[model samples]
Target: MSVAPVLEKCRAEGRAALIGYLPVGFPTVEGSIAAMRVLVDSGVDIIEIGVPYSDPVMDGPVIQDAAVRALAVGVRLSDIFTAAEAVAGAGAGALVMTYWNPVLRYGVERFATDLAAAGGAGLITPDLIPDEAGDWIAAADRHDLDKVFLVAPSSTPERLEAVTAQCRGFVYATAVMGVTGARASVGEAAGALVSRTREHTDLPVCVGLGVSDGDQAAEVGRFADGVIVGSALVRCLTEAATPAEGLTALGVLARDLAAGVGRGRS
Candidate 1:
């Protein structure tokens, strides 16, 4: 269930992979699953099921709002596995994006066990750095799940090497300096950050933070191996008046982003 294969397939196809993000239990668990299915059907290759956390330091207003709503409705940790199962069922790589605290509270080994059983590809821990990820490393390895870590523009050369060495799936290159949100521009710093990350690891380097539209996806895809989107996709559902309208908006944006990635290399 490693995401490496799907990314490799996209490489073989001469395009960057489109990775979408959605919080489980938003507008209800079933609705979230339907949104994810729409994303996959519209051309997303990998889906990051955001485990609604109380303190999401890396998320922006859009994602934070969605997570708040999800938590308010009592989204349990078990809901993550269910969402992962649905994403896998839809034929997309399913990855859980959660803070380290949740995994530790749920028992790291147990979380990995359930995720793998649910057919999940891996875990993306934003706050857990490689140096502090010993427990997660062992658990993910034991369960055969990929461990995705992040590297920002501020990462020193030594830091990049150390972090990327421990990563199993892909290295996340956080393009923006602040929290996650759709920006007017993905910025000049993102491409350079990705270039720096590539020097340290052979794993696909995916750019996230400040990416929302197809044109931006194309820009990032031109250099990075994948385009990671969250805020904008979440916004489609957050801004919609009804579930059906949200799904419609999600599909249209997903397709646009997919088309954007397709034009990356051309």
Candidate 2:
């Protein structure tokens, strides 16, 4: 259930992997699970099951609103595992993308055990750096879960080396320097960062932050090993008048993004 095989398969096929993100318990836990199914069925390779937090520092307004909605309705840390279980059952390699506090509060050992039991593949900690993540590292290793850490455009060479060294599934390359959101253009910084990070590790470098559509996904797929879309897909669900329409919009976008990934060279 490791995510590495999924990315490797995509690489073997000469295409970039399509990684999608959505906060768990958004719209509703059930709706979020349904959305992930649509994403996978349409074209997502790895699914980032965002564990909604009260304080989501790395997120922009779109994700922040969604997180707030989930929290307002009482989405708990345990509920994240429930959502992860459903997403995994739906046949996607599910990874929990959460801030650090929740893990610390939930107990790293307990979190890892439950996540593994739920059939999740790994974790994506945006606010936690690898150097300060010894406990999580130990727990993840104990459960054979992937450790996916972030390396931003501003990360220095030494910092990039440290982060990517701890990464297992793939390195999360934050393409944009600011908060996460959809943008009209994928930055030149993204390519530069991917090149810089590549100088350190052979792990797949997946670009995230501000990728809004298939065209942008294609643009990023050229240099990145994977393309991650968050705000755009969340917007499809959040802005839709009904849950069914939301799933339909998400599927259409996922199809387009999947095609975008294929447009890239291996």
Candidate 3:
């Protein structure tokens, strides 16, 4: 379930891959799984199955709200695997996005083992840096799971090189210097950051943060290997009046973003 192949396929087709994010157990566990299936059918190449944590420091209000609701309904760590299994079954690479503390609490080796058994693509640990990820790195390697680390606009040349070296599926390039959310623009520094990251590693650099619509996705796609979207997508569900409406909005936005990514090379 390595995401590299999906990104590679998108590259072969002359576009960047669409990486979508949604928290497990949002609205409901089953509802989230069904929504994720809509995303894949609508055109997301990879799905980042969010593990709803008590404290999501990197998340914006939209994602934070969803996480709170998921937690209120008692979403467990195991729910992440269930969602991942469903997403993988739908034919999209499933990667779990979680905080390092939860993984530590769950036991790094056990988390990795369970994720792999669920056919998850890998882990996108926002707060876990390579310098302190010795245990996770070892566990992920043993489980054959991809390790994705995030690099931001403020990252130093040395920092960028160090981070990208530990990454497998793709390097997550944070377009802005804040928490994750959709913005009018993805920021002017994104392209420069991507260029700087490429200086260190040959891995595909996917940009995230502040990308909301198809235009924004296409804009980021022009210089990125993939476009990572989260808050905007989550909002589709949170802002909708009904469950059916939420799914419909999710599908519409996903399809639009997919079309946007495809226009990147054009």
Report, for every candidate in turn, its global Cα lDDT versus the true structure: 0.94, 0.91, 0.94
What lDDT does model 2 reach?
Answer: 0.91
lDDT of 3 by residue, 13-128 (tens): 99999999999999999999999999999999999999898899999899999999999998888989999999999999999999999899999999999999999999999999
Query: lDDT, candidate 2, residue 227?
Result: 93
Clashing pairs in 2: none
Lowest lDDT 10-mer window, candidate 2?
Answer: 83-92
TM-score of 3: 0.99
Model 1 over residues 51-106: C-alpha lDDT tens digits?
99999998889999999999998989999999999999999999999998999999
* Candidate 2: RMSD to truth: 1.1
lDDT of 2 at 63: 95
What is candidate 3's CA lDDT for residue 123? Answer: 98
Lowest-sum lDDT 10-residue window in model 3:
179-188
- Which has the higher TM-score value, candidate number 1 or candidate number 2? 1
Pick the winner on lDDT between candidates 1 and 2.
1
Q: How much is the lDDT of residue 185 in candidate 2?
A: 87
- Per-prediction TM-score to the true structure, in the order listed: 0.99, 0.97, 0.99
| Candidates, ranked, lDDT | 1, 3, 2
